[model samples]
Target: MKKILIQQLFITTLMLGLSHNALAEDKKPATDSTPRQSTMIILDGSNSMWGQLQGINKIVTARESLKTLLENAHGNINFGLLTYGNKKKSCNDFTLVSKPEDYDKKKMLRNIRKMNPRGRSPIADALKQAAKNLPAENAHILLVSDGEESCGGDPCAVAKELRQSNPGLQIDVIGFRDEKEAQLECIAENGNGAFVVADNTERLKTLLDGVQAKARTIVNVTGTPVDGNLPGSIEVSIKSTHTGGTPSRANFSIYRPDGSNIASFTSRIQVKEYLEPGEYRVKAQWKGQSYTNKVIVQSGKTSTLRFDASQSGMLRLSSLNSNKEAVKANYSVYLANGDFISRHVHQDNVDLRIPADEYRIKADFDGTIQEKNISIEPNVDNNHVFRFE
Candidate 1:
């Protein structure tokens, strides 16, 4: 009996030990979050977005979506609003309905209600302007667009350029009954964001409001840490080589990880800055150019973070007659989102860092032949090649 009792006790102990071990194996560890990111909402007031559906105009549905987005947003998340309906020519046309601040249900809803659809879909211009509303902190842009550019501008190209300029910007695009829905997908993928489509206004409202809530929450920034450390400050070395024409004189800023101004390097081909620890945003001129990389500073450790910028991508235009490659082809590239990457072109390759997703590439060879709907993938450095005739 004593032996049996002892054996039973041993069995129980073993089982408990195994259970603990299994629990340890199955348990997932928690990660550290770096505070929060900022979000900007650009609601499309284009006429197409105003189409009627289910006894309501799409613009009305968009308003409801804005309300939902507002209601769902976290109390701390900041958001700004810009409307484009009545005016499309001037950056002043799209008025700042609101700057990124706390959630204001009444204000947001009212702004939506006040939006009158009357202007063209100047998406690229709107996006470029919207960038001003957002701080250089970890930020995202949720742009809702319907139809392609009635104004005949490339929103997808704008998104691609912005993304290449800053790999950190998250651009989420929503298409409401867009015949050109495919293009917006390029914008989202390249911008490190998602592209969603809504068949109706309710869905659009639900998605936007819900997504806005997520955007309003706290955001932590992440990136490659510098290998080494310097006690006081770190040196940032940048080399920008423009493949084509001479780069225009430009000025931009970089914010440290702590959201502090670490260094202000003049916009030039080569420059350097002394920075402290934290994430930083290096803003270049509006000429639509920039790239990202890192260098580390440690008390006792010396490390270097290497970043290379070249216009490369997974999407290529093939079947180029040897003649096409022989001479410079003036071309512009467009991503899926209603954005324009290149309005003007060169005969050879233009280095645009596209997103890591499937895309539709459009090429205007010699400004006469328009080749549209070319599929592309991200991680484009060497995975793809272009041959255009």
Candidate 2:
């Protein structure tokens, strides 16, 4: 009887062990296998976006196109909306309307509809802000602007800066009624992105479709081998393809294949250096902006990289009394559609770096209010005097 009990106990223990294993297997956690990608839509809210394109305002066309784009962007992708010139007139007029999260078409459309173009086009500042808002290391940016940088900011320089910080950042640009193709193209190139022109709503939709397609597609890069250099030594060259001019000076930070900082140097315009045959990360800074990229220096061959640079402008606001003399007063600026830009309190003069745009100025001198309209041109010092009678 004791022998029989011992055999039964062993069988029971074995069954319990098998049952525990089955329970543990059933409780295994599930994880998503899909890769996550992020895209920030930097929409232009400057007054220029209100201009007509094919019988409809640019803003309306953009909204419709974006609606379609978002509808198609449904997947494991995060979408965020950022707008410049929609809220205020200051050069720092960028607002993160929506934070990047799981794709939400309705929320994005609602936010886009709420935007009213009233301020200056601070394209560079917007780009800089996008860099900070996006948490993804390899984020994609889609900038749709009806005009060039209206605020005194260099979009190309900022794009280069973002590239330096995040080598995988891509910035695609859509120019709506923008005449400066080279400027927008330079921005795209600096961000290692694409540029497209949209003259009408149909074209805008087409361009957006292309952007979506590119976003969904994965790119496979294959490097070619070269000859002539010594073993473990490779030749590298840096080039500038900016529109305005070459950067005065550029600083480079090199990283080894093991992700350790190896060396750094400051150079001008184009730079060439001999490096070891391996994977490397390079960060270049120029004109207050940073750009980062990767290079696989193969033994015996040379690799050339390119950068871009652009220009900006400034605006000065001064106050005058009926006597044509400078006087201290409070000022309120607005876009043509009566949207508020900014307000300066009790100041005789205010200097601001702004993109080119038409503005309405309202001055309050000791409780008396006066209004005037002014237009600012790019690449020059725009001085506006508010005469309070």
Candidate 3:
């Protein structure tokens, strides 16, 4: 009887020990083997950053907020920095302040402290340059800007190009004290990222916290345009040029004369709005190219706008002096209905697209003015040389 009791006790003890070992194994934390993500901060150093926001200079506020954000960033993620408008007066001003690597808070903070805002805001150029600094795939970009692209480049087009080329690239935009929300939002949507507004330091910190969390996750991120309905009853028809055919996919933004967006559409063929009768700007993006034209709308008539992407021909203008040498000149283009289309100055050679039509051309070189009528045929390239003899 004593042997039997001892054996039973031993069995119970062994079972308990096995159960505890199983439980311990179950509670062990799983290891994460995902690759560390990278992020590039595209900072705007335009002169407008000097403007006051809540009675503090925006540049100063941005630097402080960025410093705080960087200090609190995750240790595993790599970070880089790029800035524009600080190097020169040209729109191509962009500088890579830091190459992406493991987080170094002190180094990033020092670079932020040295940024001085000057010149025009070249948001598009900055974005392109920042994209180059990131990995070819699955890289993240955070653009902090106080204004829109003051340079000639189209940020929306550039964003679209980056996204198409690198489907894994994400580009979030932070618009600080920015009034051009539509433009920034477009960039974010096209770049497969989010757009957030930060009016102060606290808000910026909160936003950066979210971004940091996003950077650490292993999930894929995507973006889409904001949902909204057209406001007006005016009918607008958008058609591709005769040669290019109709664009299967495109984005449109219609602005009032005062530059306020009245309507926007994504991947749409026609737009119907109740816009007031006046002149407006119609901007369209298709297949990485941007087109803009001034449109006149009548109260009850449907306005038709055509984009001459394929059917349009190139019109090149050049000037020569009495000695038969190339000289800079000014030129103006007018439509068949006598409406001025565009003007160029100080150009020795100007090349532009014009829809198939009969129109008047004018050129001025050293006070000599020449006017002539010419016809542009569809799918043709035409060159005109003006002699100032």
Models 1 onward score TM values of 0.45, 0.48, 0.48
lDDT tens readout by residue for model 3, 1-389: 99999999999999999999999987653345556557889888889888887888878877876776678665545788998888687787888888775346687888789888887888888888888888875498888888888888899899989989999887777776556767877787677665556664433554565555545443323321111111112334345644256534567777877767755767654443334446888776555434567877543233567665565667888999999999999998876665556678989788877667787899998888998888988768889999999
Query: Taking the tens digit of each residue's C-alpha lDDT, what string does model 1 give over 102-198?
Result: 4355777777787877667777788887777777766678887776665567777888788777766778776665467766665664565545565
Model 2 stretches with alpha carbons more than 4 Å out: 1-33, 200-206, 218-389
**Can you tell me which runs of candidate 1 are displaced by over 4 Å?**
1-34, 87-92, 200-389
Candidate ranking under lDDT, highest first, comes to 3, 2, 1
Query: Residue pairs in steric clash, candidate 3?
Result: 232-273, 232-274, 233-273, 233-274, 234-273, 234-274, 244-310
lDDT of 1 at 160: 77
Residue 282 CA error for candidate 1 (Å)?
35
Cα lDDT, model 1, residue 122: 70
Q: What lDDT does the true structure give each of the candidates?
A: 0.55, 0.67, 0.71
Error of 3 at 220 (Å): 13
Candidate 3, residue 33: Cα displacement in angstroms equals 7.6
Candidate 1 or 3, higher lDDT?
3
Top lDDT model: 3
